[model samples]
Target: MNDPDRARPETPPGHRGVQYAGRALCWSLAGGMTTAAVDIVLAPGFHAWPVLWPLPWYLTCVSAVAWAVLRAREKAAALRLAADEDLVQGQDWERAA
Candidate 1:
């Protein structure tokens, strides 16, 4: 039943609901903007918190994404660790004396 014509190209999904990277970036940017806006609204001080309106939001988004990505990676690693059984393979577990 081998059919060379039946081969399918594969594409993987990205993290969290955002599949496309560009789309994720755009959304992240919007989230960052919202964060900054909220901050400005909550604590109004143009002179003291001048940079909070623009930079923090973007940085916040970056940090949030980075954290989520890192967390995902960590979770994957932990799962892999649980499945690791190299010691049980190609060997015998006789009592060492």
Candidate 2:
């Protein structure tokens, strides 16, 4: 089996931007759940995330961001030519000089 942790080429920042936005959306959902649970059960003085107040809006935003990221990935994948086309010009990375 191949290791999935092999280094990826530097994708354009647009790809990264979409990915990070999706991550934030996930965090927002998690944080909101924690905050709401705390409010319903914990005492008043405990620290809580700001996620609860947005409620439905946060969920909607997260869903939208996820959809956008999926679309972007599809587009990028469609544009990629092939494995051999994305190679270093001179030599293989694992070979001796």
- Tens digits of per-residue lDDT, candidate 2, 1-97, equal 2226555456643666666667767777776677667667873553443444557457758666675877677567646623334454224543435
- The Cα local distance difference test for each model comes to 0.55, 0.59
TM-score of each: 0.38, 0.44
On TM-score, the candidate that comes out on top is 2
Any runs in candidate 1 off by more than 4 Å, and if so which? 1-52, 85-97
Instruction: Find the candidate with the highest lDDT and give its number.
Output: 2
Q: Candidate 2 clash total? A: 0
